[model samples]
Target: MDLFTYYRSTSSYRVRIALALKGLDYQAIPVNLLRDGGEQLKPEYRAINPQGRVPSLRTEAGRVITQSPAIIEYLEERYPEVALLSSDLIVRASQRAVAALIGCDIHPLHNVAVLNRLRGMGHDETEVIAWIAHWISEGFNAVEQLIGDDGWCFGASPSVADVYLLPQLYAARRFNVELSACPRILRVEQLALAHLAFQQAHPDAQSDKPA
Candidate 1:
């Protein structure tokens, strides 16, 4: 398997964490989202993924999968030995809800394309940072509540929610979102970051991370 990813992309980070948790071995192909007006938009990459997005997975069977959630789901479904989702049906749905809150509801509004578009439309850096902070805080408030007093989001072990949430927290810190009030969230982040899987999958651990 080949994972085409950018080190700083939260979406890419989620897939990396899942892969690490599953103990799957894959080649990490760097898609530098910053260099030369973004390598993800290049003709060669666009051919591999028409959407021109990072974290595209090319399986050994020559199948290409796009989108972080799709790839994670594929990994979960194909390799159930490590079980990122809960076996309990309702708990599983709740876990998916938390993942969606971060992956879908919040991350998109602050994605590079959205931020770049905001800049193009005359938003200043401070305003853009405010935009990011607003959504993260609002989103994390609910996340903090949902995550409640658990080592992971839904249990003693990290689940799909934890995989998605940890990356969002990384984004929150990068953009200076205030997390001091959310102790539960901070604890979860600390616990998840301390885990070997997450440690291995961190942005700094990536081969493409800039010094």
Candidate 2:
């Protein structure tokens, strides 16, 4: 397997966490998001993923999978020994919901593409930064209300929800979103850092991390 990834991509980070938790080893194919007018957008990469996204995973036998959620779901289904979802149906649904809350809801609004689109529309840096902060705070409010205060999002083990949440927390800090009110979320973030999977998947640990 080969993972086409960019260091700072939150979506890519989620996949890395899932892969590590599954105890899978794959070749890291770095796609520098900041070099040569963004490598993901280049013709060579577009052929690999027309969407030009950060995470494009090619299976060992050469099946390309795009989108973080789909890739994680595939991993969960294909490699079930270390399940990322809860056994209980309701709990599993809740786990997926939290993951989507961040992945589908919050991150999309703050991703580099969206910000660049905002810039193209004549939005200034101040306005763009404010936009990112506003969206993250709004999302964190929902997360704070739902997630428990502990090391994990669901139980003793980190679920798909935690895989998703940690990356957004990274984004929150990057955008300077105040998380003081979200004590549970912050607590989980602190605990997650101590875990090997999370640490291994951190942006700083990526091969593409800036020097």
Candidate 3:
């Protein structure tokens, strides 16, 4: 398997964490998102993923899969040896809700494309940072309320929902979103940070980290 990724992308980070948790041995192919007018938009990379997105996965069968959520779901479904979703239907629904709150709502609003658009419209760095902070805080506060104080989003063991949340929290800190009020989320983040899978999947741990 091969994963085409960019270091700081939370989407890519989510997939990386999933792969690590699954104990999958895959090759990392870094595609710098910023250099040379964004390599993800380059013709070569687009051929692999016309969406020009990071974290595209190529399986052993040489089939390409895009979208972080889709890739994570594929891992959970295909490699169910170590379950990432709860056995109970209701618990699974709750976990999926948490994942959707972050993936569908928070992520799209603060993605690179949205920030770049703001900059293009003449928003300065401070303004751009403010925009990011506002959205993340609003979204995270709601999510934290939903999360409560548990090791994982649902109950105990790490689930697919957690694999999605931790990376988004990393982005929250990067954009200066105050998390002191989000004790539940902060607790989960700390727990996940201590785990090997999460540690190995950090942006700084990537081979593409800039010197």
Candidate 4:
């Protein structure tokens, strides 16, 4: 398997965490999102992922998979030994709700493209930063209530919620969102940081991170 990834990309970070937790091995093909006028926009990369996004997975049989959620679902289905979701129907739905809350509601508002678009529309740095913080705080407020108070998001083991939450936390901190009110979320971050899977999949651990 080959993964086209950008080290700092939260979407790529989620996929890396999922792969590591599942104990899957794959070659990392760094796609420098900022180099040479954004490599992902280049023709070469568009051929790999027409959407020109990072975290495209090329499977062993040479099939390409795009989008982090879809790739993660594929991993969970294909490698069931270390399940990222619960077997209980209601619990699975709850876990997926948390993942979607972060993946869809929170993360995209502050995405590079969105931020760039805001800048294009004459929003200044302070305004863009405020925009990021607003959405993250709004979503995290709900997430703090939805998740459990103890280890991990749902229970003793990591779930799809954990995989999704950690990356969004990284983004939150990157944009300097105040997290004082989200103690439950911070506790989960503390536990995840100690886990080997999360450690290995961290942005700093990626080969393409800047010096």
Could you say which candidate leads in TM-score?
4
Q: Which stretches of candidate 4 lie over 4 Å from their true place?
A: none
For candidate 3, list the clashing residue pairs, or say none.
none
- lDDT of each prediction vs. the true structure? 0.93, 0.92, 0.90, 0.95
Put down candidate 3 lDDT per residue, 1-211, tens digits, no spaces. 9999998999999999989988999999999989988999999999999999898999999999999989999998889977888899988888889899999999988899999999999999999999989888988888888875767777778888888898899898887788999888888888898999999999989999998
Candidate rank order under TM-score:
4, 1, 2, 3
Among the numbered candidates, top lDDT falls to: 4
TM-scores, one per candidate: 0.98, 0.98, 0.97, 0.99
Model 3 / residue 75 / CA error / Å: 0.8
For candidate 3, the TM-score is 0.97
Query: Model 3 segments beyond 4 Å from truth?
Result: none
For model 4, what is the alpha-carbon lDDT of residue 50?
100
In candidate 3, how many Å is residue 36 off? Answer: 0.5
For residues 1-211, what per-residue lDDT tens digits would candidate 4 score against the true structure?
9999999999999999999999999999999988998999999999999999888999999999999999999999999989999999998999999999999999989888999999999999999999999999999999999999788899999999999999999999898999999999999999999999999999999999999
Task: Write one digit per residue (lDDT tens) for candidate 2, span 72-154.
Answer: 99999999988999999998999989998999889999998899999999999999999999999999999888887656888
Which residue runs of candidate 2 sit more than 4 Å off their true CA positions? none
